[model samples]
Target: MNIQDLRYFHELVNLKSYTKTAEKFGVSQPTITAAVKRLENKLGTTFLIRDQSHKSIIITRVGMQFDEHVQSILNELRIAEEEIKQNESATIPFGLPPIIGRNYFPTLVPTLLDKGILHRLNVIENGSYDLYHLLLDGHINFSMLGLTKVNPEPGIRLKIIKHYPMNIIVSKKHPLAHKKAISFKEIANENFIGLSSDYIHTRALDRMLKQSKISINTIYRSPDVMVVKSLVAQNLGISYLTTLSITKHDDVVSIPLLDANQPEFILAAATRENHIMTAKEEELWDILTK
Candidate 1:
Protein backbone atom coordinates (compact mmCIF):
# COMPACT_ATOMS: atom_id res chain seq x y z
CA MET A 1 0.00 0.00 0.00
CA ASN A 2 2.98 2.27 0.70
CA ILE A 3 6.44 2.62 -0.84
CA GLN A 4 7.94 0.72 2.07
CA ASP A 5 5.39 -2.04 1.56
CA LEU A 6 6.23 -2.19 -2.14
CA ARG A 7 9.94 -2.34 -1.31
CA TYR A 8 9.30 -5.09 1.22
CA PHE A 9 7.18 -6.91 -1.30
CA HIS A 10 9.90 -6.77 -3.92
CA GLU A 11 12.56 -8.01 -1.53
CA LEU A 12 10.34 -10.70 -0.04
CA VAL A 13 9.45 -12.07 -3.47
CA ASN A 14 13.02 -12.17 -4.68
CA LEU A 15 14.47 -13.47 -1.38
CA LYS A 16 11.56 -15.90 -0.93
CA SER A 17 12.05 -15.82 2.82
CA TYR A 18 10.28 -13.45 5.12
CA THR A 19 12.94 -13.87 7.79
CA LYS A 20 15.78 -13.13 5.36
CA THR A 21 14.00 -10.12 3.93
CA ALA A 22 13.41 -8.81 7.45
CA GLU A 23 17.04 -9.26 8.42
CA LYS A 24 18.35 -7.68 5.23
CA PHE A 25 16.19 -4.60 5.65
CA GLY A 26 16.71 -4.36 9.43
CA VAL A 27 13.08 -5.08 10.33
CA SER A 28 11.52 -7.75 12.51
CA GLN A 29 9.91 -10.79 10.91
CA PRO A 30 6.65 -9.77 12.55
CA THR A 31 6.91 -6.37 10.87
CA ILE A 32 7.39 -8.05 7.49
CA THR A 33 4.51 -10.44 8.15
CA ALA A 34 2.26 -7.58 9.20
CA ALA A 35 3.27 -5.50 6.19
CA VAL A 36 2.46 -8.30 3.75
CA LYS A 37 -0.77 -9.06 5.58
CA ARG A 38 -1.77 -5.42 5.41
CA LEU A 39 -0.98 -5.33 1.68
CA GLU A 40 -3.10 -8.47 1.12
CA ASN A 41 -5.91 -7.07 3.23
CA LYS A 42 -5.81 -3.74 1.37
CA LEU A 43 -5.93 -5.57 -1.97
CA GLY A 44 -8.48 -8.13 -0.71
CA THR A 45 -6.33 -11.02 -2.07
CA THR A 46 -3.49 -13.26 -1.01
CA PHE A 47 -0.19 -12.69 -2.82
CA LEU A 48 1.74 -15.61 -1.37
CA ILE A 49 0.73 -19.06 -0.29
CA ARG A 50 2.64 -20.69 2.54
CA ASP A 51 2.74 -24.46 2.84
CA GLN A 52 2.43 -24.99 6.57
CA SER A 53 3.63 -28.61 6.47
CA HIS A 54 6.67 -28.09 4.22
CA LYS A 55 7.42 -24.52 5.40
CA SER A 56 7.59 -23.39 1.76
CA ILE A 57 6.41 -20.13 0.25
CA ILE A 58 4.97 -19.86 -3.24
CA ILE A 59 3.81 -16.93 -5.36
CA THR A 60 0.33 -17.11 -6.87
CA ARG A 61 -0.63 -15.84 -10.33
CA VAL A 62 -1.94 -12.62 -8.80
CA GLY A 63 1.30 -12.20 -6.94
CA MET A 64 3.29 -12.59 -10.17
CA GLN A 65 1.15 -9.95 -11.89
CA PHE A 66 1.52 -7.59 -8.99
CA ASP A 67 5.27 -8.15 -8.97
CA GLU A 68 5.54 -7.22 -12.65
CA HIS A 69 3.68 -3.97 -12.08
CA VAL A 70 5.69 -3.17 -8.97
CA GLN A 71 8.92 -3.86 -10.91
CA SER A 72 8.00 -1.36 -13.61
CA ILE A 73 7.02 1.31 -11.11
CA LEU A 74 10.25 0.88 -9.11
CA ASN A 75 12.42 0.83 -12.24
CA GLU A 76 10.84 3.99 -13.58
CA LEU A 77 11.21 5.72 -10.26
CA ARG A 78 14.88 4.75 -10.05
CA ILE A 79 15.58 5.92 -13.61
CA ALA A 80 13.89 9.23 -12.96
CA GLU A 81 15.90 9.73 -9.80
CA GLU A 82 19.12 8.89 -11.68
CA GLU A 83 18.28 11.40 -14.40
CA ILE A 84 17.49 14.09 -11.91
CA LYS A 85 20.72 13.45 -10.04
CA GLN A 86 22.69 13.55 -13.29
CA ASN A 87 21.11 16.85 -14.19
CA GLU A 88 21.67 18.45 -10.81
CA SER A 89 25.18 17.14 -10.30
CA ALA A 90 27.54 15.33 -12.58
CA THR A 91 26.71 11.90 -11.25
CA ILE A 92 29.23 9.99 -13.31
CA PRO A 93 29.07 6.23 -12.97
CA PHE A 94 32.67 5.49 -13.91
CA GLY A 95 34.51 2.19 -14.30
CA LEU A 96 38.14 1.48 -13.53
CA PRO A 97 40.02 -1.61 -14.67
CA PRO A 98 42.04 -3.72 -12.22
CA ILE A 99 45.33 -3.18 -13.96
CA ILE A 100 47.90 -0.90 -12.24
CA GLY A 101 49.65 0.87 -15.06
CA ARG A 102 50.21 4.17 -16.88
CA ASN A 103 49.01 5.98 -13.78
CA TYR A 104 45.36 4.99 -14.12
CA PHE A 105 42.90 7.74 -13.31
CA PRO A 106 41.12 6.51 -10.18
CA THR A 107 44.09 7.97 -8.38
CA LEU A 108 42.80 11.27 -9.66
CA VAL A 109 39.51 11.11 -7.76
CA PRO A 110 40.61 13.74 -5.26
CA THR A 111 41.78 15.91 -8.11
CA LEU A 112 38.42 15.52 -9.83
CA LEU A 113 36.78 16.65 -6.62
CA ASP A 114 39.20 19.52 -6.26
CA LYS A 115 38.50 20.66 -9.80
CA GLY A 116 34.73 20.61 -9.21
CA ILE A 117 34.43 18.15 -12.09
CA LEU A 118 32.50 15.53 -10.16
CA HIS A 119 29.79 16.35 -7.68
CA ARG A 120 29.70 12.63 -7.00
CA LEU A 121 31.69 9.89 -8.68
CA ASN A 122 30.38 6.36 -8.58
CA VAL A 123 33.46 4.37 -9.45
CA ILE A 124 33.42 0.64 -10.13
CA GLU A 125 36.74 -1.16 -10.25
CA ASN A 126 36.79 -4.50 -12.04
CA GLY A 127 38.25 -6.38 -14.98
CA SER A 128 38.42 -4.65 -18.35
CA TYR A 129 35.86 -6.94 -20.00
CA ASP A 130 33.36 -6.39 -17.21
CA LEU A 131 33.99 -2.63 -17.33
CA TYR A 132 33.37 -2.67 -21.09
CA HIS A 133 30.02 -4.39 -20.61
CA LEU A 134 29.08 -1.96 -17.85
CA LEU A 135 29.67 0.90 -20.29
CA LEU A 136 27.74 -0.87 -23.08
CA ASP A 137 24.77 -1.41 -20.77
CA GLY A 138 24.81 2.25 -19.69
CA HIS A 139 25.39 1.26 -16.06
CA ILE A 140 28.40 3.56 -16.10
CA ASN A 141 28.94 6.95 -17.68
CA PHE A 142 32.50 6.19 -18.75
CA SER A 143 35.36 3.76 -18.20
CA MET A 144 39.07 3.34 -18.62
CA LEU A 145 39.58 -0.04 -20.29
CA GLY A 146 42.29 -2.20 -21.77
CA LEU A 147 41.82 -2.17 -25.51
CA THR A 148 43.55 -3.54 -28.58
CA LYS A 149 43.44 -2.67 -32.27
CA VAL A 150 41.64 -5.95 -33.02
CA ASN A 151 38.17 -7.05 -31.96
CA PRO A 152 37.23 -4.00 -29.94
CA GLU A 153 33.77 -3.93 -28.43
CA PRO A 154 31.05 -2.12 -30.38
CA GLY A 155 29.23 1.04 -29.17
CA ILE A 156 32.20 2.44 -27.33
CA ARG A 157 34.00 5.68 -28.25
CA LEU A 158 37.49 5.68 -26.80
CA LYS A 159 40.47 7.98 -26.57
CA ILE A 160 43.67 6.03 -26.10
CA ILE A 161 45.77 7.40 -23.23
CA LYS A 162 48.79 5.21 -23.94
CA HIS A 163 49.89 1.77 -25.03
CA TYR A 164 50.84 -0.53 -22.16
CA PRO A 165 53.84 -2.45 -23.48
CA MET A 166 53.93 -5.89 -21.88
CA ASN A 167 57.44 -6.47 -20.55
CA ILE A 168 59.44 -8.81 -18.33
CA ILE A 169 60.28 -7.99 -14.73
CA VAL A 170 62.76 -9.64 -12.39
CA SER A 171 64.48 -9.02 -9.09
CA LYS A 172 67.73 -7.11 -9.32
CA LYS A 173 69.53 -10.11 -7.84
CA HIS A 174 68.22 -12.44 -10.56
CA PRO A 175 70.68 -13.62 -13.15
CA LEU A 176 68.81 -12.02 -16.02
CA ALA A 177 68.51 -8.62 -14.33
CA HIS A 178 71.58 -7.29 -16.12
CA LYS A 179 70.34 -8.37 -19.55
CA LYS A 180 68.93 -5.67 -21.82
CA ALA A 181 66.07 -7.84 -23.00
CA ILE A 182 65.20 -11.45 -23.71
CA SER A 183 62.87 -13.39 -25.93
CA PHE A 184 59.95 -15.30 -24.45
CA LYS A 185 61.90 -18.47 -25.23
CA GLU A 186 64.80 -17.45 -22.97
CA ILE A 187 62.51 -17.56 -19.95
CA ALA A 188 61.04 -20.94 -20.92
CA ASN A 189 63.18 -22.86 -18.44
CA GLU A 190 62.83 -20.28 -15.64
CA ASN A 191 60.26 -20.34 -12.89
CA PHE A 192 57.54 -17.85 -13.85
CA ILE A 193 54.81 -15.96 -12.07
CA GLY A 194 51.78 -14.97 -14.08
CA LEU A 195 48.67 -12.95 -13.55
CA SER A 196 45.48 -14.93 -13.26
CA SER A 197 43.44 -15.60 -16.42
CA ASP A 198 40.68 -13.33 -15.08
CA TYR A 199 42.70 -10.38 -16.34
CA ILE A 200 42.42 -9.10 -19.95
CA HIS A 201 46.20 -8.82 -20.20
CA THR A 202 46.62 -12.43 -19.16
CA ARG A 203 44.03 -13.53 -21.73
CA ALA A 204 45.80 -11.61 -24.47
CA LEU A 205 49.12 -13.17 -23.49
CA ASP A 206 47.61 -16.64 -23.34
CA ARG A 207 46.14 -16.25 -26.81
CA MET A 208 49.35 -14.81 -28.24
CA LEU A 209 51.55 -17.51 -26.66
CA LYS A 210 49.18 -20.22 -27.82
CA GLN A 211 49.40 -18.94 -31.38
CA SER A 212 53.18 -18.65 -31.13
CA LYS A 213 53.43 -22.08 -29.53
CA ILE A 214 55.24 -20.49 -26.60
CA SER A 215 54.75 -22.19 -23.27
CA ILE A 216 55.62 -20.64 -19.90
CA ASN A 217 56.13 -22.64 -16.74
CA THR A 218 54.31 -20.67 -14.11
CA ILE A 219 55.14 -21.64 -10.53
CA TYR A 220 52.57 -19.31 -9.09
CA ARG A 221 49.64 -17.24 -10.25
CA SER A 222 48.02 -14.33 -8.45
CA PRO A 223 45.18 -11.94 -9.09
CA ASP A 224 46.60 -9.04 -7.09
CA VAL A 225 48.92 -6.73 -9.02
CA MET A 226 50.88 -5.68 -5.94
CA VAL A 227 51.26 -9.29 -4.88
CA VAL A 228 52.63 -10.32 -8.28
CA LYS A 229 55.01 -7.37 -8.25
CA SER A 230 56.11 -8.21 -4.71
CA LEU A 231 56.72 -11.86 -5.63
CA VAL A 232 58.91 -10.79 -8.52
CA ALA A 233 60.74 -8.30 -6.30
CA GLN A 234 61.50 -11.08 -3.83
CA ASN A 235 63.08 -13.18 -6.55
CA LEU A 236 60.37 -15.77 -6.14
CA GLY A 237 59.62 -15.76 -9.88
CA ILE A 238 59.69 -13.58 -12.95
CA SER A 239 56.52 -12.03 -14.35
CA TYR A 240 55.23 -9.93 -17.22
CA LEU A 241 53.43 -6.61 -16.93
CA THR A 242 53.06 -3.29 -18.69
CA THR A 243 55.80 -0.73 -18.33
CA LEU A 244 53.33 1.67 -16.77
CA SER A 245 53.01 -0.62 -13.77
CA ILE A 246 56.69 -0.28 -13.08
CA THR A 247 57.71 1.62 -9.98
CA LYS A 248 61.09 2.65 -8.68
CA HIS A 249 61.96 -0.51 -6.84
CA ASP A 250 65.36 -1.11 -5.39
CA ASP A 251 65.28 -4.81 -6.17
CA VAL A 252 63.20 -5.01 -9.35
CA VAL A 253 64.12 -4.34 -12.97
CA SER A 254 61.68 -4.39 -15.92
CA ILE A 255 62.96 -5.32 -19.38
CA PRO A 256 61.46 -5.55 -22.82
CA LEU A 257 60.57 -8.91 -24.42
CA LEU A 258 61.28 -9.67 -28.07
CA ASP A 259 57.99 -11.46 -28.67
CA ALA A 260 56.16 -10.38 -31.81
CA ASN A 261 52.90 -9.98 -29.91
CA GLN A 262 53.85 -8.09 -26.83
CA PRO A 263 50.11 -8.05 -26.43
CA GLU A 264 50.66 -4.45 -25.50
CA PHE A 265 47.38 -3.20 -24.17
CA ILE A 266 45.95 0.25 -24.84
CA LEU A 267 44.50 2.21 -21.95
CA ALA A 268 41.62 4.41 -23.03
CA ALA A 269 38.70 6.39 -21.71
CA ALA A 270 35.48 5.00 -23.14
CA THR A 271 31.97 6.33 -23.44
CA ARG A 272 28.79 5.03 -25.03
CA GLU A 273 28.04 5.98 -28.65
CA ASN A 274 26.41 9.36 -29.24
CA HIS A 275 26.48 10.11 -25.53
CA ILE A 276 26.20 13.81 -24.73
CA MET A 277 28.61 14.83 -22.03
CA THR A 278 27.57 17.00 -19.13
CA ALA A 279 29.76 20.00 -18.38
CA LYS A 280 31.30 18.25 -15.40
CA GLU A 281 31.63 15.02 -17.37
CA GLU A 282 33.33 16.96 -20.16
CA GLU A 283 35.70 18.55 -17.66
CA LEU A 284 36.58 15.17 -16.19
CA TRP A 285 37.06 13.71 -19.65
CA ASP A 286 39.35 16.52 -20.59
CA ILE A 287 41.39 15.92 -17.46
CA LEU A 288 41.72 12.23 -18.33
CA THR A 289 42.39 12.61 -22.07
CA LYS A 290 44.68 15.58 -21.72
Candidate 2:
Protein backbone atom coordinates (compact mmCIF):
# COMPACT_ATOMS: atom_id res chain seq x y z
CA MET A 1 0.00 0.00 0.00
CA ASN A 2 2.91 2.32 0.84
CA ILE A 3 6.42 2.56 -0.68
CA GLN A 4 7.89 0.79 2.33
CA ASP A 5 5.29 -1.96 2.07
CA LEU A 6 5.96 -2.34 -1.66
CA ARG A 7 9.72 -2.48 -0.97
CA TYR A 8 9.10 -5.14 1.68
CA PHE A 9 7.04 -7.15 -0.80
CA HIS A 10 9.70 -6.81 -3.48
CA GLU A 11 12.43 -7.94 -1.09
CA LEU A 12 10.32 -10.84 0.14
CA VAL A 13 9.68 -11.96 -3.45
CA ASN A 14 13.37 -11.63 -4.26
CA LEU A 15 14.60 -13.48 -1.16
CA LYS A 16 11.64 -15.92 -1.19
CA SER A 17 11.67 -16.05 2.62
CA TYR A 18 10.05 -13.72 5.13
CA THR A 19 12.73 -14.55 7.75
CA LYS A 20 15.58 -13.73 5.34
CA THR A 21 13.87 -10.50 4.26
CA ALA A 22 13.39 -9.57 7.92
CA GLU A 23 17.09 -10.19 8.57
CA LYS A 24 18.13 -8.10 5.54
CA PHE A 25 15.95 -5.14 6.50
CA GLY A 26 16.87 -5.37 10.18
CA VAL A 27 13.22 -5.75 11.14
CA SER A 28 11.37 -8.34 13.21
CA GLN A 29 9.72 -11.28 11.41
CA PRO A 30 6.36 -10.26 12.81
CA THR A 31 6.80 -6.72 11.42
CA ILE A 32 7.50 -8.14 7.96
CA THR A 33 4.49 -10.46 8.23
CA ALA A 34 2.27 -7.58 9.28
CA ALA A 35 3.47 -5.42 6.37
CA VAL A 36 2.78 -8.14 3.76
CA LYS A 37 -0.60 -8.97 5.27
CA ARG A 38 -1.66 -5.33 5.29
CA LEU A 39 -0.52 -4.99 1.65
CA GLU A 40 -2.51 -8.08 0.63
CA ASN A 41 -5.58 -6.80 2.45
CA LYS A 42 -5.35 -3.43 0.71
CA LEU A 43 -4.86 -5.02 -2.73
CA GLY A 44 -7.70 -7.55 -2.29
CA THR A 45 -5.64 -10.24 -4.03
CA THR A 46 -3.34 -13.06 -2.99
CA PHE A 47 0.07 -12.17 -4.34
CA LEU A 48 2.13 -15.06 -2.99
CA ILE A 49 1.63 -18.71 -2.06
CA ARG A 50 3.77 -20.48 0.50
CA ASP A 51 5.24 -23.83 -0.38
CA GLN A 52 5.17 -25.46 3.06
CA SER A 53 7.28 -28.43 2.01
CA HIS A 54 10.15 -26.28 0.79
CA LYS A 55 9.46 -23.34 3.13
CA SER A 56 9.66 -21.07 0.08
CA ILE A 57 7.23 -18.45 -1.19
CA ILE A 58 6.11 -18.45 -4.81
CA ILE A 59 4.62 -15.47 -6.66
CA THR A 60 1.18 -15.97 -8.15
CA ARG A 61 0.15 -14.86 -11.68
CA VAL A 62 -1.39 -11.67 -10.29
CA GLY A 63 1.82 -11.03 -8.37
CA MET A 64 3.86 -11.42 -11.53
CA GLN A 65 1.67 -8.83 -13.28
CA PHE A 66 2.01 -6.39 -10.39
CA ASP A 67 5.79 -6.92 -10.09
CA GLU A 68 6.45 -5.06 -13.36
CA HIS A 69 4.72 -1.97 -11.97
CA VAL A 70 6.54 -2.33 -8.67
CA GLN A 71 9.91 -2.49 -10.43
CA SER A 72 9.09 0.65 -12.43
CA ILE A 73 8.16 2.47 -9.23
CA LEU A 74 11.47 1.46 -7.62
CA ASN A 75 13.39 2.61 -10.69
CA GLU A 76 11.62 5.96 -10.59
CA LEU A 77 12.48 6.36 -6.92
CA ARG A 78 16.13 5.65 -7.66
CA ILE A 79 16.13 8.24 -10.46
CA ALA A 80 14.53 10.78 -8.16
CA GLU A 81 17.23 10.26 -5.55
CA GLU A 82 19.97 10.48 -8.17
CA GLU A 83 18.52 13.77 -9.49
CA ILE A 84 18.41 15.27 -6.01
CA LYS A 85 22.04 14.35 -5.43
CA GLN A 86 22.99 15.70 -8.83
CA ASN A 87 21.40 19.04 -7.91
CA GLU A 88 23.34 19.26 -4.62
CA SER A 89 26.73 18.29 -6.09
CA ALA A 90 28.21 16.73 -9.24
CA THR A 91 29.60 13.20 -8.98
CA ILE A 92 30.25 10.45 -11.46
CA PRO A 93 30.30 6.83 -10.40
CA PHE A 94 32.20 5.13 -13.21
CA GLY A 95 33.13 1.54 -13.95
CA LEU A 96 36.16 0.33 -15.86
CA PRO A 97 37.59 -2.98 -17.03
CA PRO A 98 40.14 -4.55 -14.67
CA ILE A 99 42.95 -4.29 -17.21
CA ILE A 100 42.32 -0.58 -17.75
CA GLY A 101 41.95 0.12 -14.05
CA ARG A 102 45.28 -1.57 -13.33
CA ASN A 103 47.30 -0.11 -16.18
CA TYR A 104 45.79 3.21 -17.27
CA PHE A 105 43.58 4.94 -14.69
CA PRO A 106 46.06 5.51 -11.86
CA THR A 107 47.63 8.50 -13.60
CA LEU A 108 44.23 9.96 -14.51
CA VAL A 109 42.56 9.45 -11.13
CA PRO A 110 44.70 12.02 -9.29
CA THR A 111 44.14 14.65 -11.95
CA LEU A 112 40.36 14.12 -11.90
CA LEU A 113 40.31 14.33 -8.11
CA ASP A 114 42.32 17.56 -8.21
CA LYS A 115 39.86 19.12 -10.65
CA GLY A 116 37.59 19.72 -7.62
CA ILE A 117 34.42 19.72 -9.70
CA LEU A 118 34.31 16.00 -9.01
CA HIS A 119 32.43 15.77 -5.69
CA ARG A 120 32.87 11.99 -5.63
CA LEU A 121 34.19 9.27 -7.90
CA ASN A 122 33.72 5.53 -7.61
CA VAL A 123 35.72 3.18 -9.78
CA ILE A 124 34.98 -0.54 -9.99
CA GLU A 125 37.11 -3.08 -11.82
CA ASN A 126 35.03 -5.84 -13.34
CA GLY A 127 34.64 -7.89 -16.51
CA SER A 128 32.99 -6.39 -19.59
CA TYR A 129 29.75 -8.41 -19.37
CA ASP A 130 29.33 -7.43 -15.74
CA LEU A 131 30.06 -3.81 -16.68
CA TYR A 132 27.36 -3.96 -19.38
CA HIS A 133 24.76 -5.18 -16.88
CA LEU A 134 25.80 -2.52 -14.34
CA LEU A 135 25.39 0.20 -16.92
CA LEU A 136 21.98 -1.19 -17.98
CA ASP A 137 20.80 -1.48 -14.38
CA GLY A 138 21.74 2.18 -13.58
CA HIS A 139 24.25 0.94 -10.97
CA ILE A 140 27.01 2.87 -12.79
CA ASN A 141 26.74 6.22 -14.54
CA PHE A 142 29.32 5.22 -17.14
CA SER A 143 31.42 2.21 -18.11
CA MET A 144 34.44 1.40 -20.27
CA LEU A 145 34.14 -2.02 -21.90
CA GLY A 146 36.00 -4.07 -24.50
CA LEU A 147 33.46 -5.26 -27.04
CA THR A 148 33.64 -6.43 -30.68
CA LYS A 149 30.57 -4.51 -31.83
CA VAL A 150 28.16 -1.94 -30.47
CA ASN A 151 24.72 -3.32 -29.67
CA PRO A 152 22.67 -0.41 -28.37
CA GLU A 153 20.28 -1.06 -25.51
CA PRO A 154 16.98 0.85 -25.29
CA GLY A 155 18.24 3.61 -22.99
CA ILE A 156 21.98 3.48 -23.54
CA ARG A 157 24.47 5.49 -25.63
CA LEU A 158 27.81 4.09 -26.71
CA LYS A 159 31.00 5.68 -28.02
CA ILE A 160 33.83 3.58 -29.43
CA ILE A 161 36.96 4.89 -27.75
CA LYS A 162 39.50 2.73 -29.53
CA HIS A 163 39.93 -0.31 -31.74
CA TYR A 164 42.64 -2.69 -30.53
CA PRO A 165 43.97 -5.37 -32.86
CA MET A 166 44.18 -9.05 -31.97
CA ASN A 167 47.54 -10.76 -31.72
CA ILE A 168 48.87 -14.26 -31.02
CA ILE A 169 51.00 -14.21 -27.89
CA VAL A 170 53.64 -16.82 -27.12
CA SER A 171 56.86 -17.12 -25.16
CA LYS A 172 59.81 -15.19 -26.61
CA LYS A 173 61.57 -18.53 -27.19
CA HIS A 174 58.65 -20.00 -29.13
CA PRO A 175 59.06 -20.55 -32.87
CA LEU A 176 56.00 -18.48 -33.85
CA ALA A 177 57.40 -15.43 -32.08
CA HIS A 178 59.69 -14.72 -35.01
CA LYS A 179 56.83 -14.66 -37.51
CA LYS A 180 55.21 -11.40 -38.62
CA ALA A 181 51.81 -13.04 -38.45
CA ILE A 182 50.48 -16.46 -37.47
CA SER A 183 47.39 -18.12 -38.89
CA PHE A 184 44.70 -19.79 -36.81
CA LYS A 185 45.63 -23.17 -38.33
CA GLU A 186 49.25 -22.75 -37.21
CA ILE A 187 48.14 -22.35 -33.55
CA ALA A 188 45.26 -24.84 -33.70
CA ASN A 189 47.50 -27.69 -32.50
CA GLU A 190 49.34 -25.55 -29.95
CA ASN A 191 48.42 -25.75 -26.27
CA PHE A 192 46.34 -22.63 -25.62
CA ILE A 193 45.93 -20.51 -22.53
CA GLY A 194 42.52 -18.94 -23.04
CA LEU A 195 39.92 -16.71 -21.44
CA SER A 196 37.14 -18.59 -19.68
CA SER A 197 33.97 -19.52 -21.60
CA ASP A 198 31.87 -16.93 -19.75
CA TYR A 199 33.87 -13.93 -20.98
CA ILE A 200 32.61 -12.00 -24.00
CA HIS A 201 36.12 -12.08 -25.54
CA THR A 202 36.11 -15.86 -25.32
CA ARG A 203 32.72 -16.06 -27.04
CA ALA A 204 33.96 -13.85 -29.90
CA LEU A 205 37.12 -15.95 -30.25
CA ASP A 206 35.10 -19.17 -30.20
CA ARG A 207 32.79 -17.94 -32.96
CA MET A 208 35.73 -16.99 -35.18
CA LEU A 209 37.62 -20.22 -34.53
CA LYS A 210 34.50 -22.28 -35.19
CA GLN A 211 34.16 -20.68 -38.61
CA SER A 212 37.78 -21.55 -39.42
CA LYS A 213 37.27 -25.20 -38.37
CA ILE A 214 39.90 -24.66 -35.70
CA SER A 215 39.71 -25.34 -32.00
CA ILE A 216 42.24 -24.30 -29.43
CA ASN A 217 43.76 -27.04 -27.33
CA THR A 218 43.04 -25.14 -24.13
CA ILE A 219 45.44 -26.17 -21.37
CA TYR A 220 44.58 -23.32 -19.00
CA ARG A 221 41.47 -21.19 -18.46
CA SER A 222 41.16 -17.99 -16.45
CA PRO A 223 39.14 -14.78 -16.26
CA ASP A 224 42.27 -12.69 -15.73
CA VAL A 225 44.05 -11.47 -18.86
CA MET A 226 47.32 -11.24 -16.96
CA VAL A 227 47.11 -14.89 -15.92
CA VAL A 228 46.69 -16.01 -19.52
CA LYS A 229 49.65 -13.81 -20.50
CA SER A 230 51.81 -15.29 -17.76
CA LEU A 231 50.97 -18.88 -18.78
CA VAL A 232 51.93 -18.04 -22.37
CA ALA A 233 55.18 -16.48 -21.15
CA GLN A 234 56.00 -19.70 -19.29
CA ASN A 235 55.83 -21.57 -22.63
CA LEU A 236 52.84 -23.53 -21.35
CA GLY A 237 50.55 -22.38 -24.20
CA ILE A 238 49.85 -19.76 -26.86
CA SER A 239 46.94 -17.35 -26.55
CA TYR A 240 45.03 -15.01 -28.83
CA LEU A 241 44.86 -11.69 -27.03
CA THR A 242 44.45 -8.00 -27.71
CA THR A 243 47.42 -5.77 -28.46
CA LEU A 244 46.50 -3.65 -25.47
CA SER A 245 47.04 -6.71 -23.26
CA ILE A 246 50.36 -7.71 -24.84
CA THR A 247 52.17 -4.49 -25.85
CA LYS A 248 53.74 -3.83 -22.44
CA HIS A 249 54.70 -7.42 -21.60
CA ASP A 250 58.44 -8.18 -21.73
CA ASP A 251 58.23 -11.94 -21.03
CA VAL A 252 56.01 -12.73 -24.01
CA VAL A 253 56.05 -11.89 -27.74
CA SER A 254 52.96 -10.90 -29.74
CA ILE A 255 52.47 -11.55 -33.47
CA PRO A 256 49.63 -10.25 -35.57
CA LEU A 257 47.17 -12.85 -36.88
CA LEU A 258 47.45 -13.52 -40.62
CA ASP A 259 43.81 -14.43 -41.30
CA ALA A 260 41.93 -12.52 -38.62
CA ASN A 261 41.56 -9.07 -40.16
CA GLN A 262 38.78 -7.66 -38.03
CA PRO A 263 39.68 -5.44 -35.09
CA GLU A 264 40.35 -7.58 -32.03
CA PHE A 265 38.01 -5.61 -29.85
CA ILE A 266 36.45 -2.19 -29.63
CA LEU A 267 36.90 -0.45 -26.32
CA ALA A 268 33.89 1.76 -25.70
CA ALA A 269 32.37 4.14 -23.16
CA ALA A 270 28.63 3.99 -22.49
CA THR A 271 26.13 6.03 -20.49
CA ARG A 272 22.40 6.29 -20.08
CA GLU A 273 20.87 7.64 -23.32
CA ASN A 274 19.08 10.70 -21.96
CA HIS A 275 20.98 11.39 -18.79
CA ILE A 276 22.75 14.73 -18.30
CA MET A 277 26.53 14.43 -17.90
CA THR A 278 28.47 16.17 -15.17
CA ALA A 279 31.35 18.39 -16.37
CA LYS A 280 33.94 16.04 -14.88
CA GLU A 281 32.45 13.00 -16.63
CA GLU A 282 32.30 14.88 -19.89
CA GLU A 283 35.97 15.84 -19.49
CA LEU A 284 36.93 12.27 -18.63
CA TRP A 285 35.13 10.96 -21.70
CA ASP A 286 36.99 13.45 -23.84
CA ILE A 287 40.31 12.39 -22.35
CA LEU A 288 39.50 8.71 -22.91
CA THR A 289 38.39 9.14 -26.50
CA LYS A 290 41.20 11.51 -27.44
State the lDDT at 245 in candidate 2: 70
lDDT of each: 0.79, 0.78
Give residue 179's lDDT in candidate 2 (0 to 100): 90
lDDT: worst 10-residue window of model 1 = 100-109
Leading candidate by TM-score: 2
TM-scores, one per candidate: 0.66, 0.73
Q: Of the candidates shown, which would achieve the greatest lDDT relative to the real structure? A: 1
lDDT of 1 at 163: 83
Candidate 2 regions exceeding 4 Å error are 8-63, 79-91, 102-120, 196-199, 260-263
For candidate 2, write residues 1-290 as lDDT tens digits: 58988888888888889999999999998888888788789989888998989988889988878778888889868875775575465556678887666665665666666765334666777888888887877777787788877777798888887778777788998988889876777887899888876466686778668867987788779988888888888899888777777656459998887775454677787888757776677787776565
